[model samples]
Target: MASTRTTRLDRKQVIDTALRLLNEVGLEGLTLRAIAAELNVKAPALYWHFKDKQALLDEMATEMMRRMGWPSEDQSADWREVITAAMQGLRAHLLRYRDGARVYSGTHFTDTSYAGPMETFLARLTTQGFTPAAAVRGWHTAYSYTIGYLIEEQAMTGRTFDLTARAERLADHPLAAQAGEEMFGDYDAGFDRGLRAVVEGIGATLRAPGAPGKGRGEARA
Candidate 1:
């Protein structure tokens, strides 16, 4: 039931406009009105496509997932490599936009097309003898780690990483002063280390006795 003016704008156009607004003003400031203004259309024009801001947000999240494209077919790679690539791909994709991870984390997509990437990756774990429950938990843990890391990474974008600044104010705080360098040095390396731990921990569970979907006595006693 779109008017002539509204009919001119397709759903994809509206979503693109909204994403541009999101980059300019961020998630907190991204309003339907703002998107409308960017599109040079009335807010009601957008209503023809999106019922509300949440709908718009959901599309945006789905669009980002789509934009990531399907995962590559690395036939020789093990489950760990595949899982690592998927997690790191998500983190990299989320970092592309301002407040990308936050926007992605907060919304639920109506698009089920994301299942292509998701199911394939989960199948990899399941093939390695992981129960559905264990696979889901492991996937969630890796995803949560990526989201949390990206949130912290995005939050630190504009801040200076000077340990000396901390040294001036927190000189009396011995532990903070001692660990400031460790805290700020090489976020990329820190993230990789954490990612390895997550992958390794998931693998450990697969090898642990009493883990679901394993042969009896398959692992250590």
Candidate 2:
């Protein structure tokens, strides 16, 4: 019962179909068979494009990066500004699909399309007095925070919570109730504040005595 259109199926076609199906079925329900059905192809036809579910996910993450566009080539901005913008943009893109953060985490990219932009970003950091290793670490920290935040955020989506009721129920545990209240308030402002702390923490590391460049503007005269 395969459609004639199935014969024209390509990798992009498969990945695109998978992404579309992702929002509908989410990461747990999205399977090669589902994508194949959506594309009007047999499950085997999908295997021809992706060897397995993980392979498809890897490529899907790659496609997500492509859609996210790249950091600007302009290096005039401070490294902290660059990290904030990039992480915030990543959060927005991950919010676009159900389980998007899950799909992106722990998946290897299937292509080198990310390399050029990453190189540019690293170069920007180095010019701002980050050692190559420090630049890599800083980026990883920010990336980890963004991914972790979205994972929790997506998991909580559409779930009705009665924070006040919970707090009253936990009135015996005053600190726990207060913590829960704080955790549920204004995720946007919380994310911004947390990201600022991350950037500032990294900046502190770089400025510590004996650190590379010693200071942001002190990069090897």
Candidate 3:
């Protein structure tokens, strides 16, 4: 039997091995058997730590969140700044791994481990005077927007179209054609502008009197 220290090391090794495999083979290729083989361990040993493949995936997602410093200790910033920075950090982290957004989208948040960032976000929003329900809604809105935007941004990168191609395609719409060149010229700026707009809109909604209270009850931990 492995010592407790050895067991912990083995679990970390298995998870790290799985992450590397995920990066190399994409989510579809990640599996317990594959990870065990990569870690030079038996599949049964992995199962000892993870009930099944989904459990492993959940652990992987949780690990990814930890890597990004979710549940941040710093509470110095206002809600808007904190949320925006968190979203931006999420986008950057997703961009770091292939098919990262897909992985994140599929992961469940019912697990408190997976809900750390969200809990922190809602707590901040509620502190800023948002109702619990409003804070939850706002958190979901920002999260959805960030993930959706990142998906679109990643998809755009895979396209072959350049400014000239876009310009020609939009020639019938003269104004659009002119805008295409400038749009393509500074795509990063456009991304930031869109993010800023979303954050500002959410902020405005929170600031409005009677917009909505956090909701009828207290927030869940």
Candidate 4:
């Protein structure tokens, strides 16, 4: 049983405090003790609200998802448009904090409210001629792409690595310099172009007869 003092602390309050501390400390430094200190509570008190650090992380990710406006209600938009918008929103949200992608990665959501919205989103895709499996897979691919991109993006921008020194080393290599420019320049445009390519590939799978959820006869004899 939680003690009177522990019970008095709100779960939301603890999670919010952890998020604020996350920006200050990054993931490595975001311990339960740190959060408790931020809230002016004992470590045990937080245990009443969160079983462990991972549990707290799960809730933080859930809150991030909620803020990102997941399951956005763009039912009338094309499936590709829906996917692009979702990935874009996710990238933007994750970039808002230090190590945001790392924090969000691999954490289970404590909230089940997202399930209903996900079901509706999937249903909309099926209604628009996608096989349920294909719809899910396509979205997974896009989600993976977004997360992976942000991980690299955050690493590049969040760190104090000397880009100028590296550029000097590669100055003799014209192609490498140009590649660096393409990679480090205009993140927004690069993400959109990559997302477009991914969406296009997913669209191609829809017409492939052997693709998951497609009819057997749909393939060319």
Identify the leading candidate in terms of TM-score: 2
User: CA lDDT of each candidate?
Assistant: 0.79, 0.84, 0.70, 0.79
Sort order, TM-score high to low: 2, 1, 4, 3
Off-target runs (Cα >4 Å) in candidate 1 are 1-7, 74-76, 206-221
TM-score of 4: 0.83
What TM-score does each of the candidates earn?
0.85, 0.90, 0.72, 0.83
Which digits, one per residue and each the tens of the lDDT, describe model 4 over residues 57-151? 89999888777766457555566667777789889889898889988889999879668767876766676668889889888889899888888
Q: lDDT tens digits, residues 128-211, model 2?
A: 778889899999899999899889888888888789999999999999998775677777887898899998888888533444
lDDT of 3 by residue, 43-123 (tens): 777777888887787777767776785646554446666777778788888887766776677665424665666666777
* TM-score for candidate 1: 0.85
Give the winner by lDDT: 2
Q: Write the per-residue lDDT of candidate 1 for residues 74-144, one digit (tens) a residue.
A: 43346677778888888888888889988888789877988877787777777666777787888888999
Off by over 4 Å in 2: 1-6, 207-221
Alpha-carbon deviation at 179 in model 2, angstroms: 1.7
Which regions in candidate 3 have their CA more than 4 angstroms from the true location? 1-10, 31-37, 41-53, 70-76, 109-111, 114-117, 156-159, 175-187, 210-221
Q: Which is the better candidate, 2 or 4, if ranked by TM-score?
A: 2
Better of 1 and 2 by lDDT: 2
